[model samples]
Target: MVRRMTMELAVDVARAAVQSCRDAGYQASAVVVDRVGIVQAVMRDTLANRFTLQAAEDKANAVILSGVDSSEFRLNRQDIRPEINQIEGVLMMDGGVAIRAAGSIIGAVGVSGAPGGDKDEICARAGVDEVQDRLDFAD
Candidate 1:
């Protein structure tokens, strides 16, 4: 079975993402999900639109389902993007990144509400980086 991150860790990651985006002058939301696409934690910036929450969750779920970052999945599978997007909670877009430790995927972090997906992804990576040390040392 795939391992999952602690609730505290998940929350930290989500908060970090939101903070990162805020630092960049963009209001955003972040979602952390287990390997099974189950939501573990969610953080939304105060100025972020409520709709951003669903976008963030969908991005994270896409990572869990594809075993890769959402951007790569979307780029690599363009032919199927049309049909894949029709699936509930599955978004083939950027701003989603897998959370990995010791070569294993523990979860994912997805960010949304930035002006561009790439910017959102940068915040997501920052969030994951915030907890990288803890994740690297995890048992």
Candidate 2:
């Protein structure tokens, strides 16, 4: 059976992600989604770009659906799997990460509005790591 992260947990993760991005001096939008690609939480920094929300959501969906970081999709362009991108809200680009705990994906996090994709990914990973302890405890 797939164990899902609670809504409260999702909020905590999203908050942590947003905080990390702010600390890094980048205004960003953070999105959290469950394993099945359903949105859980979306938080945007006060100074984030207006488009960050959608971009973050798309990245999160992409990771949740594809079971990998969105950047991986960009890196392996020739191996692109079109079917994964066909998902309604998926964005097959960058700044997203699949949350894996105990060898299973529990959710995904996406960050956007950074100066570069790499920066966005760093913020996203920070958020994921913030919640890593919780995931480990659950295991």
Global lDDT of each model?
A: 0.93, 0.84
Runs in model 1 lying further than 4 Å from the true structure: none
lDDT of 1 by residue, 1-139 (tens): 5567999999999999999999999999999999788999999999899999999999999999899999999999999999999999988889999999888999999999999999999999999999999989877
Across residues 101-129, which tens digit of lDDT does each residue of candidate 2 receive?
Answer: 77788999988988887888888888888
Best by TM-score: 1
List residue ranges in candidate 2 displaced over 4 A: 79-88
Residue 119 C-alpha lDDT in model 1: 95
TM-score of each: 0.97, 0.89
Clashes of 1: 0
**Cα lDDT over the full model 1:** 0.93
Q: Between which residue pairs do clashes occur in model 2? A: none
